[model samples]
Target: MNARDPSLPLQADELSGLADFAASAWDEEIVPALTDYIAIPAKSPMFDADWAKHGYIDRVTRDAAAWVESKKVAGLKLEVIRVEGRTPVIFFEVPATKSGSTDTICLYGHLDKQPEFSGWRSDLGPWTPKYENGLLYGRGGADDGYAVYAAITAILALDKQGIPRPRCVGIIESCEESGSSDLPIYIDMLRERLGNVSLVVCLDSGAGNYDQLWLTTSLRGMVSGVLKVEVLTEGIHSGDASGLVPSSFRILRQVLDRLEDSKTGRLLPDSFHCEVPAARVAQARATAAILQDEVWKRYPWSCGADGAFTLPTTTDPVEGLLNRTWRPTLSVTGVEGFPDLGNAGNVLRPYTAFKLSLRLPPLIDGNEASLKLKTLLEDNAPYNAKVTFVPDGRAGALGATGWNTPELSPWLDQALNEASNAHFGAPLGYIGQGGTIPLMSMLQKGFPKAQMMVCGVLGPKSNAHGPNEFLHVPYGKRLTAAVAQVMAAHP
Candidate 1:
């Protein structure tokens, strides 16, 4: 419907008051629900085939919506939208209080979590949420379970002070980790109800650090699938067929060689890369300068006997950052048909599978990239063997267009900076995150004119998608305050 403005601008005193409310809500409400959420193990559709059958995702969506409804905010409309077969989306709206306004703001997040990874320090586990030293260690907390709370906290915080804001609609789905395959369905079904969103806030992204607000300028696309190769009909004894069998693993390596160089660790084909935008390169250099040693130290580098491998021989952090964020890279994330060391035997295998995950530059095309990958790996197979590369996420293809920076209004920018400086004594940090958020491209296409403000608590040492992943408690509180401040100042 119509919207009215809050006091037009958020002041220093308002920020302090917002922070106080945020801290209290975080301690009394957010933490408890998030802890319970972590324990559920609501894995994405991609990771958990039984997600629908198990019903954990549905529980997460409904429980989360009910919790928000439990808050009893004024004019709040909440519901758990579920298609017959697709995953659920927690859809809700907070009607605008002010008059003569039609601007709608869409806030987004997801409930799905990545699978539990290895290596947890202290008494930590993926499903067991532990609060220690201002950090909540668990999966999905920072990578994004906090978004709905943050967005609602902002709205409620503003509402508590009688500050009016634009009508806010939120959609937190259960399929983000699975390339957001189900999200577009929700978007399409609710397109008319969503209205013309003037601004969008995504709290599922990366940050340089916890010192201040960080805005993601661009996101690299991703192409992932399983590459399987088969040779003989069955496993053969090494003594009987070692020489003549031509190991299947060797053939798999040959297929990979067509895509990447095993020696220098570079993508071999030119089809996978694109020229980095000059401004992005400059931004990378600036971000590198700001982060300094943090650019490399953020990673958990190993120190083995002969000294751990050097970080790919970059002359400076800027080159390393650009190479990582704006360049296409290939990583073999998983493998099959190989036994563990203790279970190993002197035997040749019939087939081998390498799980392929390739990151694409912002300007590259994922559809074209996947086609090239399938062609390179499957065509002209070593011995005309059965090999397949399947893109297993959404639309029969795990492809996403890279998102460019959206234009931000001056008022919005001012709100973000003021919020950052007030909540965190440091200025806002602007950087490009290397990870993929499956919905960025879709949202940009749908809301072509909306100003996208991507912020999150996934800072250094948060270890998202890895072991010991955590949510910085204080940072989340402040992030909520920031969102509130932005909401208060929305045009």
Candidate 2:
């Protein structure tokens, strides 16, 4: 069939055609490619220090680039760009089908997977791909490995139906799981080539549920590091040091108290806190109504002997949403200077070290917060113990800043609602994600006027970083078609 006029609005049949094309592309091509991609442990640079030496990151980047080139997209220019000491990225551009259009649509996603976490179902493994009941189970597939495929599929589907769109460009990176530390350099290098980006479709976020499209309004920033406290030069017998010397573990606990309130998960520093925007608060209230108990019930909590599951900090849905997204919290992700349970002895350990991960509010400055955290933990020491908090990453780059999306333009707003209703038979939903996407903040700074469409297939129980992660294939197909609809409606 000939391509439809660029100025004409897409009809219902056209949207259906896009869906058919996406389903075919996914089942026949995307799924097979992803299954293979999942089998290769292309862990992010953060999790795998020897990523370049291992060649997994490069392999996936090359594989994705090859797949895009094989699509034979008309006027498509593709390149696998590399900066000397960093992970590689896939960059592609397709000319606009719309006449005299200068606006650019940037599609962003990552190819890196998180570390293999424990607690998978007996039959499931991190690198083992399992397709059953319309879900693809494995790591990376949902976290963002399917992004490049879906981005290209959306454009191809639009072309198949002769739908018009602005110029499209894709930037698929391989270090997102590691906080996207290498992305800023590439963005600066490609600034001119990126053109006037007016719309951004970021597929590296999450969905509130699989029912309808969910747009991420904001993301929380993150600061991670190692906090170590030392009381003695070597281990000593507990009987000899019982009351004469201070325990390192006790000192560690005291230092952490300066940062958090043990009773509540709130960060003690006032600088970490920020006023939640009224608009976001109102949206949270509406979302709470839509999700109800789902806001807190989605977690896999352990049950007690009384046959009751563990409770969350709050049962109120609105407060739950606000707490996770807007509030600052601390977590101890890893520990060191300890022995295995089987090898533990009755000796006082010399030191205690904890890998601390602090989630900051969206409006806070990550660099400043990280600096403050280092000082808070390292400066004052109980018993004059040797304490130190070293932030992650290189000398200057410490933490990743969060992003609050720019207000949606009228055309894009209407387009999102229309696409949601047409594709999923529901209206668009807005919510904030607690996870951090470092690229969003960079893009917002670079393209201050751009409208962001941050949506993904990571829905309930489709854990991205945890075990038993899976991608909802049906929702992916609908989302691809919906993306095409939105791009076609872009003015």
Candidate 3:
């Protein structure tokens, strides 16, 4: 049997000690630690000019590293690792117990957050952490801040029970919210320092609901660019330009109309290629069976009591879920040419630009998609307008398949099932998240043979990256217990 297999069985006393440790450590300590962590406003570099100057990121990283070190688990040493021009990654490890008996397991998470957008309800702020109605509220509470606490709590609980831990390394990066631009450089620098790892546990993703354990089977890649259209050299009176010259705004709208079907919110011109994988469709069907009602209820608007969208026929809940997670989607995130209230005028603006963010399917090639999109936009320019497509960012999707570790899956499933049953009074379902985790792809490339398991606590309506983002405290505690159970099961 492999070291992480819980089926091997723990002695009665060991199990009892673990249960007790989980109750004290997680209930009293870890939850509070997460609360404190959520208070830091370590927005991603794109969102903040003072990410380094404010020192919030550095402060939080050091605080987390110190907390891990204070645990003092036997054979475990904690340290902060930094590479020039990149954010610091907090690294800690519990050394292997005996030759050929223990294998290293890596845990990954991030500490950065997206800028808080407007439209929040009263009593919510970007940085201030709040707790209300069983949820812990803040920006980074769910997206990633909780992972470091969860990793430490799980390992420490095992140590308290005197169980030998598999050699484990916990890596917490600080810039994921900015698309993890610095990750590649940091990985190259630590390539030699980080040795062979058998399995990786990424604790930064979403759950289908409070009752389910979600695994991201595939992630859609993303490409973002700005589409600019220019007609006149300078602004002109609308009265003069109306009949003589085409309005730049009207022309810009015409160009965009060809790219998407506004009435249906679907992409047009057939530029994107996305086919839902058979496995992903099947998984979504299974998830929909249990979560359909909850999913509908979470939406701000409901279609009567059924909450179904208007289609010719009834839409399958599974298909709706699949569309978001596995298919390609495009959205115009921002417009640069439009003026605010005070700048209102009757003159036709000479230039207009809009930011387009496209989410590509797992099988789609990011570069190819970017090039095709650019060609389409340039070729379709109206009135012989000066059109330009400036690439912003691109990341290819990562597919999670194969490399199933003999030691991890069964234990994780069992522990998660037991915890879900106890907390939500139901069986936990597995689902895939639509969001991207660039680190997972990086790790897979570095450790080609490593088995990977991705799971986390965010659920529907958690509003991660949106206002009023929160971490459910009760759910988080239960998740911590589940992690402890997995550790006890691990050899």
Candidate 4:
């Protein structure tokens, strides 16, 4: 598009120029835009059923699409694609600079966010943007509202330095936090348009540390739903029902016991897990050696009365990494059927409901796992209490599937190390993330041979999806430059 010579390789000085360009863009444009973005409550459709009426999702999507167009990158075409009754996606493309090159690079990110979680520091609410000590703190900033902005910055950085890159396309969706339910529709519509993808740069992932570029080698799948157990039609006086009624809370616990081991925190179903690939286990061991005890120590632990901090389930770094990345786990995220503590009374609750979230290994099918989970929790109710387990997502698409990246090509492997050394002065790191990115699996299947550059700014203590989440701005800048370098090296 720039009419620049594509044969010339990026020199050391040019890489520096790319970094400087990315830094300037982040400071002057991207940061301010993300600050405004963080202030919007663009909750995903799953979290906000009235998302269309709320207009937050539309607002952010519109704003991001406008920003891309305003860049005025030569030969770049942008569009906000929409299907009836579905969330929007921002699709854009730039013609390849390399003459006769048909390879395409797909850049992916999402704009919607998790619901505002409690427990933020008094000064740092999810909707309030605060920039301090090179970190931008907010709800979606790290988990990845910064991705779309960073992706563009990477492309622009290459153009600014006259570095010829492969044809590039961007797909920024607004439904990722909701298991990317609407993305498949858009993908089907845009299949022919997204031609011959060879490299995928996904910014919706995590890092082992901020020192180097972290490539997410794999991701865990997820299945979430509400499990409810009801024993009575209405609440009754505790004095009258204590001895006569079987407690719904107790019955709920019994049902959960069927799924998880309380003491070890392991899922009981063998089908819910898969044997970790030997290659992944080897990578985990190498990553564990690099991270050491920080794997478990990075978490914010509470202190006990004796002045000692709470211990993690395991202190061994290898086990810690494997437990989180390769093992199936269950979490009770939310609960209902209880009154406020301040309004405590002598009443026995009629029913108890828990929002259950299950994380599955990468190879497992999420839909299959969700069905198995439902049967395990709902079959033969304890105390004959009415029980139901309704999995989230559309009927056939009841869970978010995980992805295991395809093996890196020889050139890509060298380029990753080269880019990391150029920008961060460190070699690239490989690690499996515990979170799910639904689009990755779809893209992997859609383009079976695409080399994935799944990296992001969500590093240690970023706390994505939790309170006080923040984006490490410095890391974001370096990652942008690194992406440019890799795109330039595509062969």
Candidate 5:
């Protein structure tokens, strides 16, 4: 982790100490500790019904708190806060050394991880941390067991260099993977202790690439639910029903066809679509130019699937980038009401079920979209077959709401460019991510004056929430340095 090559853009003492501290911490403390953390199976409450009973969540929180204590920075008070019937939060507060400074900046992340996904490379497992070829492979390394580690390391780097930092509070929660259900409660409960925040840094976001500093200007929200289609009450022989009855599966397919184009993949309903902001479109073009083929090349494209499964809009990578980040899209994330192929029989199924996940534009309302989806799916049933649309939660199952990112402060822009140019010989780049970070909206409402900065190491093929997920080691170290630079200059 400490390999220093001439290629680094370590042009300043602040950046240098930041990189060095990250390397030292990773080698001496973070890797070993994170490896143990990955082994704990700290799945979010949604995925693991027995999360509290299993105690894995609490175990990881304690481990994280212990690591912060080992840093031993002055005025560092680390607490594992447990509220009733909710996941715990690792709340660490550090007073700024800059005299008379009351500026409080919040750094947000989550230790709670997604469930172990299938299709990991042969040599890797979700619980087994493996380091090779400059990547750390394991769940939570990128999304986001590294946030607390990186946040702490950034502050300590400033400490080592005698640089003044604004008052900083790190809120590493245990419920982000569950759509941050418990985070708002804690944010409200601790509003007084949290004080006022001028700046909020969120590390639970995606970078455009690994070569330079990337900032998340906005995040896309989502609407999700299950659509069920039932034609008959009991299974029947397929041969007897083939010509006489409409297949429930076929009817379900037709319903989906109403929402999205089967060929072009464009969303069908006008209500599900929103006008993309011109500013964001311009940013996408700029980032698309910088990334070029990398926008398409980074996917594993297993077995050369890119050739066969490429999107129709692949001709213009810029459009694809916009499509991913700014445009509304739909995905059938899961399905049920059918037996596994291995256990399949000749009987016709009585019903078909599909779990839908729809990604909305950055400015769209998730509740409105959910209502549209439910109406579109259940309004007119084909052949009078029963159709049902059930939301996984209240109307907006994901509490989905996108944010129009405020303009960047001049100081933050300078810090981003300096860090980027120093480390990678490149300028800073900004892009909107397709993923949702609920805290972004909450913080905007909670502290209307705070400028939010979202950055992370989850570049393409870093594969967060997927099998073989990894944290790019070099990017992580450089990003830690970049964040330190931001903190050092926040005042």
Candidate 6:
């Protein structure tokens, strides 16, 4: 359809007005708010032993609630809802216009962030917001802080134009970075308060590129556990025990070898067996076509003898995308047996442990997979070593089939296609994201009938949950405008 198409009612005037509003407000208003929002070190509750001690979470929540209140959208009520001692949740609503027209649209995002890991450039700090080369750099800038701004900005922009809106509820959580520990309790408490909702939007995902609007069709669930192997009572000098004693590290490696193929990076355990869905495979092919040249080059580090670890030359691009989005994967994230640099010595450690992080397919049962993984690892331990398995967290994967919401597919495709065509000269493509958004599953449980649209400003090389994290300001502004378009076009 052309830009002037009457059926898709987003006129050039409306688009220009929204884009202009976003550009001006983002620079003069959103940037300052984001700067202050990023300044607070509101680490997840899991990272901080006493989250309330520093008052960072509270401070950020209050700041977000204040921003929402300042919007003053007609018929919208904003407030911070607190449960017992858990982190506060900012809730705001734009009531529906007429009777039986109250179709609630709940928007979700988080205010808290993962612990800021080390290895940052000299100019960038975790809490300090720095704008450079069209990027806003800081901890919470991309992963979540932008959501609160984006949702409010979009709704308020529409309200400024006097567009009547559905009952839009924005729920910004304070513990999303920590697996949303207290969110369920908060949801239960406010279950009655939050009435029937028809649509949901989660802005905590990444876009494929700044030029295109990416919609995630599925999310892989995460299961984290510790694998421990005890081979001896105490460390022994390598000179004396090198030939006689079995190394705990070697035994740990053997057990891990059973679960993962060392050469192919494929999980060998049988418990994680779920075939990629047909629709996702098709989406992957499209994504591969779009990302052919940029995907490999986007890697931060150079590859070894195996090249860039991409799909085989013969493999279809669609298969490559399917592998990442719909398949299960495993990685050893941390080792407990490694010694500090200063304490390193030629000694065989008696006990070794490593943190195992497994990504389950969208249809796989996380708990069952975790149990199967533990059994496989323990059974594979060499030298009859003592083994222990400790599970840390598990979240079920989420998938949205077109069959569940047939009306949504075409709406999303059109909205995204229109937005992409306006910004870049191309149609927007869909893909599945590998990262876990714990709240998706939770929201589905609480609001089973809600149709969701998961889109965000994070793009390739944005590097969320890592040092030098940044948000593309211009792209973000455009993305917010796209969100406005999508909301306005919602049926």
Let me know the TM-score candidate 6 reaches against the reference structure.
0.89
| Candidate 1 vs candidate 4, lDDT winner | 4
Off by over 4 Å in 5: 1-11, 302-312, 394-398
Task: Estimate, for each residue in 1-491, the C-alpha lDDT of model 5 and write its tens digit.
Answer: 11232223344664666778878877777767777887779999878989989999999998889989998988898888888899999888998766667889899989999999899999999999998988889999899998998899888887776677778998999988777778877888888888789999999988888889999988888876789999989989999998688899999999989999988788988876678878888888898888888887777663544556443457587887888877888888788889998989998899999988788887887767778888899988999999998765431244477776888779778878887887667899988888988788889988998988899989988999899999888888888888887776675
Error of 3 at 450 (Å): 2.4
Q: Rate the local accuracy (lDDT) of all candidates.
A: 0.84, 0.91, 0.70, 0.92, 0.83, 0.75
Of the candidates numbered 2 and 3, which has the greater TM-score value? Answer: 2
Sort the candidates on lDDT, descending order: 4, 2, 1, 5, 6, 3
Worst 10 residues of 5 by lDDT: 1-10
List where candidate 6 sits over 4 angstroms from the true fold: 1-8, 97-100, 303-316, 379-381, 394-409, 422-425
Error of 5 at 61 (Å): 1.5
lDDT of 5: 0.83
What pairs collide in candidate 2? none
**TM-score per candidate:** 0.96, 0.98, 0.86, 0.98, 0.93, 0.89
- Tens-digit lDDT track for model 4 on 1-491? 55766666678799889999999999999999999999999999989999999999999999999898899888989999888778999999998877778999999999999999999999999999999999999989877888888888888888877778889999999999989999999999999999999999999999999999999999999999999999999999999889889999999999999989999998888999899999999999999999999999899999999999999989999999999998999999999999999997999999999999999999999998888888999999987889999988862699888889888999999999999999999999999999999999999999998899999988999999999999999999999999999999898
Give the better candidate number (3 or 5) by TM-score: 5
Q: Model 1 off-target regions past 4 Å?
A: 1-8, 307-315
- Per residue, candidate 6 scores C-alpha lDDT tens digits across 245-328 of 888878877887887888877888665757766666776777888887565455476456878664442355555566666777
Worst 10 residues of 6 by lDDT: 397-406
Native-structure RMSD, model 5: 4.3
Alpha-carbon RMSD of each model: 1.9, 1.3, 4.3, 1.1, 4.3, 4.2
